[model samples]
Target: MKKVLFCLLALGFLGGCSTKEEPKDVTYDWAPPFEEVRWSMGEDAVFETLDLDEEDATLNVNPEKQRVFSFASAMETEVGMVAPDFIFEPGFGLVGVNLHYIPMEKEAAETLAKLEAAYGKSDDGTWSGTKFGELNLSDEQVAAFKKEADIDKDEPVVTIALNQDAQAVKYQECVFEGKNAAILEQVLAK
Candidate 1:
């Protein structure tokens, strides 16, 4: 009786000690809907000035080479009449999408003064000091911009051209993270 009881207790303890099965890994291979999505960068009031090469300016981005995407729209909207979008290719775990808007002629001085106070200085030499027009974004600012743009920090970036009206031309870029190919597919679908 003692032996039988001991055996039963051992079996019960062993059974209780058995390990649970691990969960199966999930694979995501289906491509995202990249074509159907079109994100608006808001109105021209928020953009800046950029110089770009007309011949090579397009959305298709090459990771190995340096490319310039410019947004200079609303040339006639206000005083200084300048709105530029500048995007540089991916580098240093960072991607840039800069917006520059110069108020029309009548407002250029005042607008520039305001911008200088807020951003820094305009690199265009329009200002005696450092050019605030040139963006020197901090890490926090970059992160915020990425969040606003819905881009992942780990992804490679692809450029997109928006707004081709004679008055304004805007540029955008898609930055991809690990396995972001799927996200790109989704963005292209819209």
Candidate 2:
């Protein structure tokens, strides 16, 4: 059931495709992942930025090579704090980082608007982020998705994005743990 939710939240938000408007040269005060890390840095730089050591991270079984550093509560970003799995492609070094973060309302809203301005909207009405603006969610879904404490309050958010070779990211589910145990098994390092 949680896997269903995770799969739904992660893979399901991508609605049918359609033609896109020419993107504008928009910028946001926020950034994807981290400015310090950005998107594509060499493995050495990534490991250094995250201060990762073999003792600190375990490699994933993925053919391309992935390392999970379970901060569950350490890293901070403009949007929110996140625990991340830094994925290093054999040659690409740091191509992607699978981040699990609870969204910060004001920041998410602000960035979402910026992304919409730049990429315009999908046929389905979702906006596009430098990644996918698929963080789109109905209020009800957001209500249901938040942790119990967040219900009715709107104090947090959960977002998930997974893609290979650092393409556009699609995400916006707000919880992990028992609810997402199945995917976590595959994504989380030992």
lDDT winner among the candidates?
2
Error of 1 at 124 (Å): 9.5
Runs off by more than 4 Å, candidate 1: 1-64, 72-82, 93-104, 120-190
Q: lDDT of all the models against the reference? A: 0.34, 0.40
Using TM-score as the measure, which candidate wins?
Answer: 2
Cα lDDT for residue 45, candidate 1:
15
Residue-by-residue lDDT tens digits, candidate 1, 1-190: 9999999999999989988533322232111112221122211212222223444334445464533355444432222234333233342211333334432444435654544453346554222212112224344444434443564444233331112122543222112122232222223333
- TM-scores for every predicted model: 0.24, 0.38
Instruction: Encode model 2's per-residue lDDT on 71-92: one tens digit a residue.
Output: 4444664434556666554433
Instruction: Indicate the residue-level lDDT of 93 in model 2.
Output: 42
